[model samples]
Target: MKKPKQKKTKEIRTSLLRRLAFLDRATLDIDARTVELAFSSEQPVSRWWGEEI
Candidate 1:
């Protein structure tokens, strides 16, 4: 079976470097993290919560 083609980190970094005039090095990296989306009125949400205001 053929392997699925996914966007690589180098490709993304190179693309960003090319688009931004000031950005030259391809040292950019992406970090994916799971975030909590629950909201509470009585308690404050965590700092890492993406859905919290």
Candidate 2:
């Protein structure tokens, strides 16, 4: 016999929503558009010349 699958509980969903809300509030204080990209090393170039590349 196969067992039944369980759904996400209310507590777990509430906690996840709360964390997302906190992250949203935190990011609101920062200027994302003015942020600069700082790469220490050079980016790699893919050798494959496929359509997905």
Candidate 3:
């Protein structure tokens, strides 16, 4: 069976925008030039990576 999709509200979007909306022009420029290199998560080890937890 298929489930119905959830609806979005303006308030939720406004909240996210509020977090990204900074007043400092220099900070905004810094963020614009930044690039993500790598990331990691502390999940349980699995045999797929030759690790056991």
Candidate 4:
């Protein structure tokens, strides 16, 4: 019998886990813009949000 080929799965790599819910501006004592910047620049989570993860 022939062996089945393995499927390729995308993996995310991050030094930290940044939860968006916890990144809220009001909770973090920062403005919305600052929170946005934090979320946007975050490496791993950014990819997941952008669907590139």
Return the top candidate by lDDT.
4
TM-score, one value per model = 0.16, 0.17, 0.21, 0.21
Q: Which ranking of candidates, highest TM-score first?
A: 4, 3, 2, 1
Error of 1 at 41 (Å): 1.4
Residue-pair clashes per candidate: 0, 0, 0, 0
- Candidate 1 Cα lDDT to native: 0.44
Segments of candidate 3 deviating more than 4 angstroms = 1-34
For 1-53, candidate 1 gives per-residue lDDT tens digits of 99899976654333433222343234443354333343335544457555453
Residue 47 displacement (Å), model 1: 3.3
lDDT of 4 by residue, 1-53 (tens): 99999999999775975455444455443444344434443344345358442
Stretches of candidate 4 exceeding 4 Å from the true structure? 1-3, 19-53
Candidate 2, position 47, lDDT: 56
- How far off is residue 9 in model 4, in Å? 2.1
| Model 3 per-residue lDDT tens digits across residues 18-47 | 223225444445647754343344555657
What shift in Å separates residue 2 of candidate 2 from its native position after superposition?
0.6
Of the two candidates 2 and 4, the one with more favorable TM-score, higher being better, is: 4
